[model samples]
Structures are given as C-alpha cells and as structure tokens.
Target: MSLPPTFDPVRALSLARETLSIEATAVNAMADRMDDSFARAVALVLGSSGRVVVMGMGKSGHVGRKIAATLASTGTPAMFVHPAEASHGDLGMITAADVVLGISNSGESEELTAILPLIKRMGVPLVALTGRVQSTLGRHAAVVLDASVEKEACPHNLAPTASTTAQLAMGDALAVALLDARGFKADDFARSHPGGALGRKLLTHVSDVMRSGDGVPRVRLDADLMTLMREISAKGLGMSAIVDGEGAVLGVFTDGDLRRLIEKSGSSVDLRALTAREVMHPNPRTVRADALAVEAADLMESNRVTSLLVVDDAGSLTGALNSNDLMRAKVI
Candidate 1:
C-alpha cells in the first residue's frame, strides 16, 4: 500500500542470493545428518515385494509425487497417495507387502497420523521423512530420516522453501542409492522412457530406420553417368553407392560431384563415357548397422553430409539413410 518501497537492484539481488545460500545450506545439512535410518529405508525399499507408497499433505505431497516418479524411473516401483485421500478408500491401493514413505515437515500432519496406526497394525514397514523426530509421525515410523532445515528462505520464516528443498534432495539421494544397488543402466532407463528424445537417441539402431533391401542406391564401379544419376534419382537419397560384385562399397557419388565434374570439364565431356569409380568419392563416411542412430547423426554433422552408407564388419553395403529419415525418427 505504501508504493511497495523504491525498486532497488542491489536489495533485490541480496535477497535472491540469501535465499539460494539458505536453501543450499539446508541440503548440505541433510547430507551430514544422514545416518543408519537412511540406509534402513533404502534397504527396505529395495527388498520390498510391493511398490513404495508415498503419502504427504500440502507442499509435502508435491515433493512426495516427484520422489515417487524418480523412484519409478530409476529401477524402483513406487507411487504417491494423498494422505487425506488414503482415509477415504485410497488406502486400498496399499498392501502388506508395500513399504510406506510418509512425509511431514512437522512430523505431525493429522491426515498422515490417522493412517499411521493402521499401517502399524498391518505390520508394514514405515519410513518417515520428517523435521521433528519427537512428534507423532516420527514415533510411529520404523525408520525416520530427518529433513529439518535451519530456517526457511522466506524472510518471515513461515513458508516451506528450504524445508521442501531438503526433502527433494533427500528423495533424490534415496532414488540414486536404490538405482546403484539394483545395477540400473542407461539401457534400462531408455526402456522406461521410450517416447522421449533421449530414448530415441539411445535405443534407435542404424538398421531400424535405414533404407535397405533394394532401397539403397547401388551401382557397379564402372557404371556410366546415366546409371549413377538414375540410381540417385530412383533411391531419392541424393547419392549413390558404388559397389563391387560382392556388394562391398567401393565409393560414393553425389550431386555435388556431378556439378564439380561438369564445371571442370566445361560441360563438353561425353556423359556416357564417365564411369562411377572415376568420379566417386572413395572411402566415404560409413556406419555399422548395430551402432546407435545418434552416432550416425554426429558423423553426418561433423562431415557436413546429408546421408551415410550403413555397412557391416565386412565393409559390405547393407543400408542407407539421409537427414530426412533421422528427422522422422526424431534423432535430429
């Protein structure tokens, strides 16, 4: 109401820096506070026959959802259930075989407290990520991981800024530890995220999208200019592969070569007499069918070429693809 104080860059920057420093300090403090409780929680999750059920209220619930996703993507089965909803039939989603991860900044969220007794009666392992060990949620939990921070980043110290940051960090630590314990690899991650661009880059093979089985523009080494142009036009790849009788790639011919040859010879050379091997670029850039599609893309960009010939270990032409194929495959 009082004109919002005068706008000052120095004061605004100081506040921003202070907030970051406070949150960073909270995360580091959580790291130092890691004890046997964190290890116990990890082991319980890893050994559980059922999924991890994560529950919280308010801002804690938001953090719990992200934690569940991280666990699911990193080789652990997990799901988030709202504490308030758990009391109204959502508890059916839980089972005796599951491990329950409860989050409460004060360790006294009433909605969580209502279901703690039931989880105990069912003999399910309870892992609590909380700020107060003496509070109700802490006492009921079998293992308690402290998520306390020195203070909130908010000037009034009333919001959940630093506290939520610590919770997220601890959640990430749990997921990463579980990932290593399970020997989760990049291929496993790619399988879980097949629709993403990174998944395409990692999972797509050179053979999956290449033009093969007569689609590749192949011609004999001694083919004439008409034969070379016909092969390129028929395949629609802007280039042709010159191969031997055994299908071994001897050289490659492209539109650029045609232009250069015509310019150098003053457009007077006999087209029918020009052979493929005489004008083709030998030892062209090639990739194996088993290699990752991203590697092929990297090669194309580095060499400034639009297409690559896919060959086998024996250097025989098997397939071919251009930039458009990579774009359609989402590897571009």
Candidate 2:
C-alpha cells in the first residue's frame, strides 16, 4: 500500500495567499486600462429611459444577479434575466429603451450570443463584460468592458475564480459611478430601502416617533416637585417639561436632576413645597419637529442628554423625543 503524503498546512496557506495576491494584482492592472470605453458605457446606461437588463449564464448568471441588485440599490434601475430563460420567451422582457449588460468571461456564451440579434433589432444597446475583446459578443456590443484575467485561481485553470471577482468589482464600479452621476442622495437610497438601517436613519423624522401635546410629560412651572414626579411617571418618559402660563417650555426636570437634588438636600422626603421650576434645568437641548431623526440623535449625543423637547420654528413646544425614540426609529 502507498503511504499517505504528510499534511502540509503551511504550504496550503502559502498557495492560497499567493492566489489572492495574484487576483489583487490583476484587479490593480484593470484600473490603468480604464479609458473612454467606461465613460461611453456609463453614458449609454444613463441616457436609457428604461432599466438596465443584465443577463448571463451559470456562474455568470449568479454574478449578474448581484450586479443587478447593486445597481438597483444604488439608484440605477436594473434587473437580471437569465439567457436560457430569455430564449424561452423572457426576451420579451427587454425593451427598446433598455440597455443590456451581458457578462461572460469568454464573450462567446452561446445562450447570450443567441439573443444579441433580437436585442439589436429592438434597438436596445448592448454592453459586454468579457475577457476576449475579439469574441463575437464583444464585437457586437456597443461598449465592451475588458474584465480579462491573466490566470485563474484554480490550480488547473478550470474554475472561474479570479475572473468572476473582477467582474463583480467592475459592476460595483459602474453602479457607484452611475449613482454619483444621477445625484442620488442618501434619502433617495432610503426610499428604495425603507426596511434597512440606512433608510431608518435618513427617512425617519422627529414627528415619526416623538410624543406630542398631552402625551409629553409636562407640568406647569408652579407645580410642586410631587406633581412633577406624577407627570413623569404618568407619561413614562422619565422626565417632565416645566411649562409657563403660555405653554412654552421654560425648563426640563429629568430623573437625574431629581436624584442629584435629593442628594444635595439630604432628603428624599416630602418636597412638594418646592415647585418644578426650582429644580429644572433651563434651556435644555432641543430639536425642531421637522428635523431628521439622525440629526436628533447627533444632538442628544453631543449635548450628553437623553431627551430633547421638540419645538416649532416659533420655539413653541410641539413634542418630546428621547434616545429611546431614536432607537425605535432605528436612527441609533
């Protein structure tokens, strides 16, 4: 019986690292090759009134789906259609206004090439990401992005590996460049991704989670300290607004203030004799009711305060918000 070769983990790691280094070098080389072709490709997609239709096959199809998703999330409207499916009547999904971005390493993928003439007949512009610039698909394309790799990470040079990675990165580059060209803002991204954390931070407003009017824990400036406690507990906000006869916020008294006051006075006993005005912190940090939730969070952190009264442009108390509100809004 032949003896089993001894395991060499060190050699295995070195080879893996070498593969990654080679792939990195290949990607760096592409940066220098980027030229007018990239600009033309961007112009074509930006000028199109319809979505960018991305199509590929096998591993290329998987990469295309991700590229489509990235483009869609970053302000470019795009969708993936499998080439095999396109031959089965999915070709109808492509419109004259659209731009087709076909990805194939060899640029000779039969399924993708088969649909080229039909797409051209419909007047849809084609962008090809391929290694072979002289291949049929590249030759037919209106713009070709060279995603060539010198070698595959696969020891036998059979797997896609480095080629696919380069394609994915190139897709990202297009999506980001298009995003900037369109002046797509964080708020725009938030609208498309309302369920994501970035959406919450950018879309949530002070009015969305603030306690308004009677819901805000507030007591008249003349109210006793005992009345203040009742107001805070009743509203469950751990703080009470000290308001004047005009209902304008004069100051705020928080649980922290009460604790400190109690410690200073050497008594947690009856203090109803003292009014809320005497113990409140004047001119507490405030936010406008129309301010972004993220701004409110910033104010809270910078002021070292947990809560802020929401006021209108006229300085009239409109609502109240706390760190808990920001958390609930996912702005934290």
- Per-model C-alpha lDDT, please? 0.93, 0.90
Q: Which ten residues in a row have the lowest lDDT in candidate 1?
A: 1-10
Give candidate 2's whole-model lDDT: 0.90
**TM-scores for all candidates?**
0.91, 0.94
Model 1, stretches more than 4 Å misplaced? Answer: 1-9, 301-304, 312-316
lDDT of 2 by residue, 256-294 (tens): 988888888876556768998788889877889888988
Model 1: how far is 110 from its true place, Å?
0.5
